[model samples]
Target chain A: MRAVVTVMLKDGVLDPQGKAIGQALHGLGFPQVGEVRAGKVIELTLDERDPQAARVAAEQMAKKLLANSVIERFEVEIVA
Target chain B: MRAVVTVMLKDGVLDPQGKAIGQALHGLGFPQVGEVRAGKVIELTLDERDPQAARVAAEQMAKKLLANSVIERFEVEIVA
Candidate 1:
């Protein structure tokens, strides 16, 4: 099975990297861009076959290592 | 409007960061994990109201600034 886990900063957390990206986008002529937030997407190929099991495992991985509970949140999606 | 752009290293490209992540996961007892690929997800809030226009603009941003075309591939999804 294949799972995708997306880790994102919690709302109201100061994201300097995102701020920089927003500024860079504006400078690059994308004036329509307003707010920009950057996050991580980790695709994991797992031996688990069951979709529910894969999702649970991915979420466990997210909680244990992929996400910082203090400032970030994560979502896990089983793709295959 | 909200747009999501995912930037990933193309297949066969060396991804040291992803390799490191996979190793770390293995160390953390996720033996079921097989291959791990890491990518970036950028969320952009735009002034454009139309989803199609927002997607186009986001793709332009991805191509021009968000993704390193020589080694990276990008996908844009617009969600208002």
Candidate 2:
């Protein structure tokens, strides 16, 4: 199975990288862009057999490795 | 309107950051994880009045600012 995991800074968390990118975009002439928040995407292939099992494993991966629970939240989606 | 732009390193491009994250996941005992590619997701609010125009503007944003076309590709999706 293939899965996509997205990890993003929680609301109210400071995102310097995102801010820098937004500034760069503005400098590049995208003046209509109001606000920008940056996050991470992880695409992974897993060998888990069952859909439920894959979801469990993917969630575990998010909690244990993919996301920093202190300042981030993650979502996982399986792609067929 | 809101848009999500995903930018990822092209295949065959070296992704040290991705590799490091993969290694960290492995170290955390996710041995079943075969490969990992890290990418960026940018969420933005746009003021464009037309959807088609927003798409065009978003594409230009990807090319000129959000993505390094030399070794990356980007996809933008509008979410309301």
lDDT scores in order: 0.93, 0.87
lDDT (tens digit, per residue) of candidate 2 on B56-75: 88889899888999999999
- Segments of candidate 1 deviating more than 4 angstroms: none
Q: Which stretches of candidate 2 lie over 4 Å from their true place?
A: none
Q: What is the TM-score of each candidate against the true structure?
A: 0.98, 0.92
Determine the TM-score of chain B of model 2. 0.93
- Judge candidate 1 at residue A7 and give its lDDT: 96
Name the candidate that leads on TM-score.
Answer: 1
After TM-score superposition, what is the CA distance of residue B67 in candidate 2 from its true location, in Å? 0.9
Residues A1-80 of candidate 2: C-alpha lDDT, one tens digit per residue: 87789999999999998898888888988888887899999987777667777778889989988899999999999877
Worst 10 residues of 2 chain A by lDDT: A45-54
Residue B62 error for model 1, in Å? Answer: 0.6
Each candidate's DockQ score against the native complex?
Answer: 0.94, 0.82
Task: In angstroms, give how far residue A55 of model 2 lies from its true place.
Answer: 1.8
